[model samples]
Target: MGLLDSWTAGSHTADGLTYPTYRKGSGPGVIVIHEIPGITPGVIGFAEQVVARGFTVVLPSLFGRPEGPASAGEALRSIARICVSQEFSLFALGRTTGCAPWLRSLARRLHDELGGPGVGALGMCFTGGFALAMLADAPIAAPVLAQPASPAPLGRARAADLGLGPADLASVKAKVAAGCQVLGLRYDRDPAVGTRFDTLRRELGDGFVAVEFPGRKHSTLTEHPQPEGVERVLAFLEEKLTTKPET
Candidate 1:
């Protein structure tokens, strides 16, 4: 059977952009942005675990083949396609990717339907930093950046930039100041992540919670889903998304 075997499939359109989405489970909404090269088997596995944890998980098919397995050739092909796609920011520095707006809209809509303090969003690899950008608009209560590798991590400027334009950066900073916290996880030796985590610390200060593992692993929840990293992510989600008892 395929990775997305029993999941319900559909498409979400916002701000003139549409992409396929798979959903499962129940409770608060959590949008799982798949890594580049598409929704691979490992990503599907992680999504399933999220579902098992009681949250309604929505796996967005942003790039690559949604049913593709995680293979080197598939990853390279997807990388080539995304590098040329207008939806991503493969080279631009300090500019949010074009796909961010669509994602933000989707998050708002999901939060509205789900009806909670807000919704959760977890982005991996090229899409990792997207959750931070999504925070500019409200309703993203839980934002996780797992190994954000965008703008190709080619230089210092691109390496540290979260791809947020000036205005969006200001908005995100405001949210952080207002007490919104973001979770980040990455391998200590992953070059693709650049120094973005350092940038997060410098900019967000205590608002950023970073969990670093000691290794060269790149895909935190997919290619190599570390037990500790997964536990941290799940606990973060529960803390942020779970409702508190009335006094």
Candidate 2:
């Protein structure tokens, strides 16, 4: 059977952009934005964990072939496609990815469909910072960034960049100040993550919950599969989406 054979397939469109989505489970919503090379087995496995936890999960196939292998060639191809696509902001400093609006729309739709505290959004690898960006405008109570690598992290400026524009950053700060918290996981030596964790700490203050592991590997919640990191993520989602917030 295919890796995603059990998931319900659908499509979501916003601002003239459309992408295929796979969904499963039922309860509070969690949008799992796949990393580079598309929805591979690892990504699917992580999504299944979320589904098994009694939360609805949506996996968006941004680029690359679904159920495709995460081989070097496939990664290169996906990188090339994203580098040229107008939907991504790979090299720009302090700019939110062009796909944020569509993702935010999806989050809004999910939250509306299943009313509650709010939905959780997790982004991995190249799309990791997307959850933070979506929190600025969407009903994303729980935002998780798993090894966010963006703007190529080529220079010092790009390295510290949070992959968010000025206005969105301000909005996120406000939300965090009010009560929202962002969860970030990354390897301490992962060069692709750059200095954004520092930036998040500086910007979000006590609101950014950072879980760092050792070594230089990336893809904390998937490729590397850090057990502690996975447990922390699941806990964070439950706290923010399932439990009622104190007023």
Candidate 3:
């Protein structure tokens, strides 16, 4: 159903977990993390975009099993549907809510099994800062965060997200101190990812770099003129995890 007419999408299982995913393209590995909309048409388009850039892009379906992006206004309604359908258990909610530990394992397996030194991550919107959390593990060599929603959920969402909750903040600071670099982008107008969120970079000392788009909104990277943004994302990764050109 995507431009990659020969789309080979299915479920990938590792460590006893089965995750629905789409895989294609060639080069170093790059995992594409979808925003609140789930893997909607736009995100699949982004996956195709990344594939065009010469990287093996994998978009996993983590919307509590049966997941796909819905209408903007119906996101909450969709959440309710996923909650009830997933059996609504506390532990299940914690595991399915955040894309951290599982994604970490997937990246590691890709590096160890798929034969890449490591993998690059592109996380956006609600998942903006997720790439940073993925970096907590060394297998993620390059992390790209776009329009990261700041940690201030009107409830439990904040606790589930990676917004530096003291202990976790301390751990990330340690990774940055050990020479990890994270690149993040945001539109100046979106209130979810505000100036205060920039403190995460400040907290990281020199390892964090944030670039701002003066007028672009939260979903700015939905398409081009955003091509350059996507290119920069790959370039940043190559800078960190580049392999020698073949002889």
Candidate 4:
């Protein structure tokens, strides 16, 4: 808590893409994945909140960040900029070349530098499935996947850009069979990820901890103040990351 109050930000690149990062606290590491827009102050605030709970926080701008600090208006403007940009690089920011290895390298550095067994990962909205995809690498011990967007059309049939393929899904199944638990948070509504994710829930079964917040929509879990879900998620992280080894 004391360390995070005076926290500072940093910049780095992962998977051959440049990204702005934030660091704080002084214990085991946790990677805080940003929402669709980027690593806004609200997301950083969330990182700080997690740091206050006594874990070191690492935030990579999956999408590029602003030249200045990001307020809501700034973040909204950034979204517009990306939407209007010719290339829309924000969507490709952290995903350059080989993303899985990039995340694994970052985790390795955090574990070796921070002196922890491994790192926890939390992804939101568009990037939610990433935490699960990352589980293929094994360094992602505790994964919190929130409101994942579609990887491929969904609904009565297929879904676009749902973010996982057969191999990735198979690896996840293997991890679950090995007793690894994954936590997922979502609101009852949000068609973009609604029923498709529910199917995944059934697919994963007991290996997945599904925490659905009634009446809330996508991304409220990461943003907090919803009168439900966020605090419960914090508790869930505590349960997984802070679990005692029973010998």
Which numbered prediction scores highest in lDDT against the true structure?
2
Candidate 2 C-alpha lDDT tens digits along 64-145: 9999988899999998999899999688988898999999999999999998899999998889999988999999999999
- How well is each residue in 97-137 modelled by candidate 4, as lDDT tens digits? 13556666777778777664467888886667678767776
Q: Which ten residues in a row have the lowest lDDT in candidate 4?
A: 88-97
- Give candidate 3 misplaced runs (Cα > 4 Å): 1-5, 14-17, 64-70, 81-98, 150-161, 164-167, 223-225, 245-247
Name the Cα RMSD for model 3.
4.4
lDDT of model 2 at residue 169?
A: 98
Q: Local distance difference test, per candidate?
A: 0.88, 0.93, 0.65, 0.65
Clashing pairs in 1: none
TM-score of candidate 2 versus the correct structure, residues matched by position: 0.98
Write candidate 1's Cα lDDT for 101-215 as tens digits: 8998889888988988799999998889889878887589999999999867887898888878888889988899999899999999999999999999998999999999999
Per-residue lDDT, model 1, residue 210, is: 92
TM-scores, each model vs. reference: 0.97, 0.98, 0.79, 0.78
Cα TM-score of candidate 3: 0.79
Report the Cα lDDT for candidate 2.
0.93
